[model samples]
Target: MWVERYGPKNIKDMVGNEETRISFLNWLKDWKKGSKPAILIGPPGTGKTTLVHLAADELGYNLIELNASDVRTKDKMTQKLGPTLSTHSLFNGKSLIFLDEVDGMYYRQDRGGIEFVQELIDSGRVPLVMAANIEDDKKVIKLIRKSKVFRFRRVVPRLVELYIEDILKKDVAKLSKESIRLIVREAKGDMRAAINTAQSLAGLSTEELSSVVSSRNLAYSLKESFEAFFNADSQEEAYKALIASKVPPRDKVKIAYLSVINSGLKGDTLIKALEKIGEADKIVNMIGTTQEWRLLRYLDRLLAYSLFNTLPKGSVSYSEEDMPWNLKVRMWNEGKVLKDIGGRLSKFLHISSREAVSIFMPYLLVVIGKEKKSLERFIRLLGLGESALKVMVKESERVFLKVR
Candidate 1:
């Protein structure tokens, strides 16, 4: 929550990446129809997505944002983003389309997603911005070919500490210099993680603080989880390690799969490990579909006893695959807003909230923008306050651009 609470309000307020931020702003400012879309590549917590949102707001552009969690099937991408790319804004303001975590797409889950995006970039009437942590990913490489790519580096420790200090001051919270330094170092140049760590340390006694920081440092990393599973000398050891792991079961399966492939397990061993991983993946999917949380208890055993046993006994180090805290916080806030809007619109339109969002809202926004009398009437009827009505009008202007 602190990540969102203290997120930069404008482009100039963003910490670190000053030159890259300026370049990004200039890219937006000088953008014309059919200009190459810019891809902002960086490590997690480096403010890539934040830069796009802030720049759009400050420059008076209507922002249309999509994330990896959204359905990225070709049809879905085309349906949701195609019009926004082709049309001009009704209010004469520019529109910026932001796609976050483009590297997360895969051939199976996001069939044709990259191709569709490439098509859009070639012909889009507005600038498109995308963020990815892995710039060299095959899919990302393809996107980069058609994009003006900017690499965002990690925030230096000193800057992260200063940012944390500013936030703590605002909250009237106190922390020792040593404690702050430890947090910044532990965060490894991740500003969001550093802030979150500081927030947890707030109000703790000196004695409690040291222990807490120690425990946080001991918390399992993804690489360590892989090592534990592969290097376990016994089934019990593997089970204990897997159970104690902080990585979610779904991600554990992915890590195991990647480890097996990367470990050079050959012929029968490779086939067997992949089979077990596939089975574990199925269990994960089943758990998700049924909400049968009890099944989760078996996942660690399946992964450890069956899949990991196939691997040679040694450590396997892999990069962390967890979603960044900043993005998680942003998505949480965005989801809440969408849910509220859907509920309000559904109640007024006598339709399901899902229908209100997927079917009615697009047309409704255009109508609201084009017909001021109707907008006023709807505002009064829906009990939308002046500020809310203004937001609606602003969003509607973007919708009208697409519809027109």
Candidate 2:
């Protein structure tokens, strides 16, 4: 959300954390592999995620990200990611592996998880990143010993004041020096928290600001996916977002193609969109096999399509909610289930997703009602109860009534 709003496309828009950001960028640019991963440790809301994404985004490197909850089992890490380490690059040259929140990973039943990840580091894939808050744990200290550690200090009040003043222009806060000092005091130098607190307080009257911070309730904004596809500041950022989205590259291409078409793109715009997706498909195909993992950089091209392929100016207005993430996730999962069903039937007949949809589905509908046992798992995954199944498949309220 902040990137779409406040992010600097280049180096100039950056506010604080100058020294660390610069050093990090320089390290990525100069990497020769075989080097240990780098760690960025900072307090919360200090743009640690943003910084990692920004660095990779600016550099055009593919990012494979893992967070704390990701299956960090010893067997899983070695068995799966083990090859990516020694094999090839995702993008022609090198790709970045980002393991955020590693400070929290120390000891467990799977004590070998951290040890195995270190083994991959020896294989020379490229740079790896780990981020955390308060690097006090013994495990974190051990990991820090293996990598260059960059500290992101809290943004000072004067720097925060400058940044906010530059953006908002007018004094939205309109506070006396005393109140400003109190806010600064309360902020503890985290500019992001301060900015957020200010945004929430802006809508409140003088009486409301005295109570508490309602702003800390802000959720991590969902705009990263959109910005990744629509207006990423850097090629690296765009590519990393697309890869991290976990949607297949082909589907990503298809979605972008449809978005452009839906935007009422025509003539040369239509021509360009088609060409872009065509190139996107080629890139996807190559990246799918290259193991060099280059399809990531091509994401910028996809995002460019989304950003420029909007409905022509004055042709259509826009709203904040194009579609909710929850709804999209559901439909996407449904589509996948449909694909799985289709794939099963396609294998039976030796054909494609299209063939299954066009031909096999009709047969299933007839036989499915009689022998509905096969559909139990899919129906459950779809969260469809007996009534929903009857309504959708049977079109018979009577069937539902009988079951009830």
Candidate 3:
């Protein structure tokens, strides 16, 4: 809710990206009288929504907002929103219709999604505003061309900390500087995240939080969580983090498997790790496809593999051609994106995530060049990047050049 509470109000409170803010301000001035809707594009928590509303408020305009979850049928668009959108004057007298996370529509791609907005722009009734974490990639060339796009960048750490501390000093008077440091550092350049981190820590421990300037979770941080779970001294800690980690069992298994493997685990111990992951995946697949609720027990088994398993195999090695840092980062990014793509694209099609991923991922991973570019765009839209996305399948279009 920090995003709600401290989200930059009136555009000026927003930190970073002076040019973007100015561009948006200029667009706001002439958006009516036939100019197309303005689009705010950027990463999540970058204040896209905040900027839009602040602009509207500063300009004294009434806001009507819609998200993908809304029924945006052509009939709905043309019949319902299309009328007042233009004829309306400004703020009670002036009104702006806002569509947020516009790319998050649930309907089929062919169901007039991008086209619907284009039609609305062509109508030119209202000065519209759109907020999405996207940019013109090849897949949406038309949208890229028609809208006046503005980018929002992440709030830097120093400014974010200042904002949070200012709010905290008012909301709760006793927060220590150490705690403030942790909250700011953990925020990872996200103001909302920073606020939430501060809030979470404040609730848990009153200790003076420190270590903000300290080197923190590295590019390879998630792997450490893997090690913590699989190599933990107790199941309790392992169980807690695993259940809470965003990683699903398939990758949990793979991550834990790879980490254990890296530590020189082999033979029965190695097989044991594989078996645990295998079971986890089996159940995960069941949940994905069959909606089998009873299979939840296997998710626990995966955590148990990390927690309860004893005397991990393989002596941990340092010099034996370690996984490259870039590759590791890519793999992690791909895992999240693939999993999300599975779930999200499925919803858009009214299919299951399991089926969605199985159907589309192989194609994306195997194809290169333009095809890869399109898939990559989709990945960026969903806010995912990584290596868990694999070139595991062969596509019919071209033979892939194998790289070492």
lDDT of each: 0.80, 0.63, 0.63
Please list the residue runs of candidate 3 whose C-alpha ends up more than 4 Å from where it truly belongs after superposition. 1-3, 89-92, 109-113, 136-141, 205-404
TM-score of each: 0.54, 0.46, 0.52
Number of backbone collisions per candidate, in order? 0, 9, 20
| Candidate 3 weakest ten by summed lDDT | 388-397
271-359, model 3: which lDDT tens digit per residue? 76567666666667878798776766557555565425654522432222246455677677656655776776676778788777777
lDDT of 1 by residue, 220-278 (tens): 66776667767788988888777776778888888777666655456887788789989
Q: RMSD for each model, in Å, please?
A: 21.1, 20.6, 12.5
lDDT of 1: 0.80
Full candidate order by TM-score, most accurate first: 1, 3, 2
In Å, residue 254's CA in model 1 sits off its true spot by 22
lDDT of 2 at 211: 48
TM-score of 3: 0.52
On TM-score, the stronger of 1 and 3 is: 1
lDDT of 3 at 16: 67
Worst 10 residues of 2 by lDDT: 214-223
